[model samples]
Target: MKKILAALLIVVSQNVLAQTTQKPVLHGKNWVAITGKPLAATAGAMTFQKGGNAVDAACAMLAATCTMWDVLSWGGETQALIYHPGQKKVFGINALGVAPSGATVDYFKDNDMEYPPAFGPLAATTPGTFGGIITMLAEYGTLSLKDVLEPAMQMAQGYPIEAQTANQIESNKDKVKEWPYSKAVFLPHMGEEREAPHAGEIFVQEDLYNTLKKLVDTEQKALSEGKSRKEALQLAYDRFYTGDIAEEIVRSVKEQGGLFEMEDLANWQVKIEDPLHVNYKGIDVFKLREWTQGPALLQSLNILENFDLKKMGYNSANYINTIYQTMSLAFADRDFYYGDPDFGQASPMEGLLSKQYAKERAKLIQERNVEDIGPGDPYPFQGGTNPFKDLLEKRKDALSYFEPENPISGLEDPFLEEFLLGTTTVQAADAEGWVVSITPSGGWVPAVIAGETGIGLSQRMQSFVLNEKLNPFNVLEPGKRPRVTLTPSMALKDGRPFLSFAVQGGDTQDQNLLQFFLNVVEFDMTVQEAAEAANINSYQMQSSFGAHESKPGAISLSTQTPPWVRNELKKRGYKMDFQERTSGPINAIWFDWKHGTFWGGSSNHGEDYGIAW
Candidate 1:
């Protein structure tokens, strides 16, 4: 009997290890590249193979993903967190576009719109990805602009369109037809049953190719004239913002009835700033400041630090409830306080990120769910007074008319659908100790193409609010960036690189990231196990996209959750929804300093892929 029991124990242990992850963790000794598409990951690998560092490889991957329209384009925004080995510090890249002149709260309200339009040329801000890419290359990267852009330029000439993007175009053809320039490029098969390209069809963008070539040409000309590398790169940047390319962009946008003027493009510039960080359990996590929703994750981590999460047990009813409540607390502050730091009344970032504030917020979690969670007064922590006390009192009434709707028999929940609006993520790391995490988004499908440039205009304007009560700091204003959902994350332990990670789902970006971090740090899960792990999402926060709808008390769980766990959550007042997979296509790299290697993980949730060597 003892012999039989010993054999059974060994078998069970092996099975438990096997079931931990569906995808294999990529082990690398030199470098690793991961992103939203396989081809884009390959682009990063190609750059790495050519002796480019992680920053150069990351730039190549970003450019390729933009060219492929992997939920983004050249006209979209790019937000990144890069770790420099020599400095032993993480830097923030604020390449997000600013609202163009004339895009004020009064301008939107005068059109009888509660918020900016969700699509078309009128929805665009000044393009930022081009400027962002050049800035990173000129500052930290060793490669020339031509070397990093070669793969994307070739792809812009022609590449096979993936089914997901192709089908997205076909389904949104009606809206695409509304924009003449977009219709000309997207509807190659006009009048046919399928107006968009079929899967695997060679999708070509001649004008986009020429636009990229023009930047390369300008850089080459400057270099031939004995300009420094940085000077040559600056010349290319000037050509885009102030030269002929700017002229064409202004003319095309205006012709399409957009509000863009020459100054909008010419005056726009990318800013490199210090990123924010909070140390949790000796591990330092870094994210961009309030302009994006990055700080919310830090806030959540700070709150969770007060809990004995591992003792609560992973995915237990207790654990899920704790996480959901903590996220609600952090996100409530995010919706009300996070916005462009350069504009409007300054947000109390120091107060909001205060450890004392998190401890106070953590005290609010009770045995039952807090359905009416509202923003907390954080000003006192930083020695300031609350200026929007009246607004806080009237906040609940703002969305009182839209009661939480019950799930219909077979219909999709519109709130959930919009809540999960996703983009693509990029992560790259090299043996030289450089690491990059990025969440570039906007200019997704149904985007309006600027005439002759073949570049789709970003629809990120929809993220703004016209009412001060909803988010006073984020209210629409000319040249002010709207509060965005794109967030990339990184962690360091004992002053050494620990993890580089990011995800796609819009508002769920930080929610998923917070859990992914805990899975590895607290539970000892492998990077792949952490990436593919089931996660629960909270829908208590206001949507950042169309209509800005939210459903309080609603929560999504993995279908794998047991019946008893579901019943326990229901008893806690959560309206439970389930999915086979709740992990947003999370991509991560674990720096194994002990082993002197890298471990890469890409979630099986989507087309996200990674390559390592």
Candidate 2:
């Protein structure tokens, strides 16, 4: 009997060690609902149908998405903004959380080796992003918190498993190894030992369910009692921050040596600031600053303005080369200067976005084949070319490039490891010619402070560092939100909202944004066509880190572009990389200022679908 039991256990262990699934795919257009995910979209769309404005719909969807798709949810923070044509005001909300008041850099000085793996406790910043939604609802939204939270509160109560949800849970099981609470909430069906389960599995979260029950009860009861808006919001915030849920998180973070403080929670405030605004060729562009690398998004538009993108053809090799030249310069600046403006000043804003810099940078995009041009305004390393064609090649089982066992680095062909952290973006427009663009995420991992609140703090710490060659007074510190790779954006031409867009796949975000923006703004493609157009991701060309030296300009291009475009780009001194899809799908909405109603479109290059009513 003992021997038989051992054999059974062995079989079970092997199954747990090996789990796989088709990666989740959620794509859409028309921007009916925009939040952290599709689940949020569904919830928000329902609210919209129930007579909510974009802000109401967004707030509701964002809250619900935090629970339904909490992988990118609260317990961390959310920094978001909106432009309302009806009000003609750009509202900004900083929903980011704050670091523990007591924690300091000395905390990490004692344990550099164990220093919370960048995304770990040492990376704990703040978790106040949802405050943005709260502030928006209070200021611009029509519905009460009770009305908006219903969809989210409902989803938290014993919700059935979604295929994508289950798949994400399974795919991220290894990530759960550090937190038992997460294991219980996610791997409930995986046996007592907490292991990965097969597909079609039904996992339940009793603790999360209870947490949802409290949130729902407060929300539902508020509506039943016809509570005032302030009362309802206070109730919700109290439940999350001052009640049991808050205690639960505080205990967790304390145990983890995190820097979160109750005062940070108590004094938490979301302020409405103006977005970083700029104009390009009669188009107005805006990106919320502070927590996002939004300036980078704007810089792309500025640089493209210096070139004649339309003359190069939409996906021509020369066109893609110009893109590489522009973005590499922009990103080089991003790596050097971007940070929390509250704590530091960014010098690159002037030079990076300047037409003079763009003109200087344009010279590097040689018309004919040119030899390796040294990286401009970029970190110095080595060899590479922007090979746009590389992204177009087909990918299947073997495309992952790296498996657990391989753990590759310093190879003949270096990988852009930065691609590991995924992000989410939404671009949609309202019927009133108001465009909506939002980028919400904490990159992969906890981004990583845990056990503090309902959600883990973001691991956005790795992106910031001290500058050696430039200004000083910027010492890495606690309580500061690190500048992110996210740069959700929009553009206006002749005082009309021309484009609503965002690129959300980490390092690829900026690259994809540059190409798609040029494709539409300069190359005259439709919104959908612009997003779908073939392009290259500069990261693949330079391989993020290792090949930053040896990386030839290997551009990762989508396969749809003309073959001649690839050959021509190569002839123009550019290197090409082939990936089935190099850039991530971009979501966009454009408003015809002359026309009263809004026109929306979805990117066809990926799993995108759009809607407008």
Candidate 1 residue 601 Cα shift, in angstroms, is 0.7
Give one digit per residue, the lDDT tens place, for model 2 in 116-151. 335455455555645566667767777776677777
Clashes of 2: 52
Model 2 lowest lDDT segment of ten = 391-400
Please identify model 1 stretches exceeding 4 Å from their true place.
1-19, 404-411
- Best-performing candidate as measured by TM-score: 1
Per-prediction TM-score to the true structure, in the order listed? 0.96, 0.78
Clashing pairs in 1: none
Residues 87-198, candidate 1: write the lDDT tens digits: 9989999999989888888888888988799888778988999999999999889998999999999999899999999999999999999989888888899999999999
lDDT of 2 at 357: 58
**For candidate 1, which ten residues in a row score worst on lDDT?**
402-411
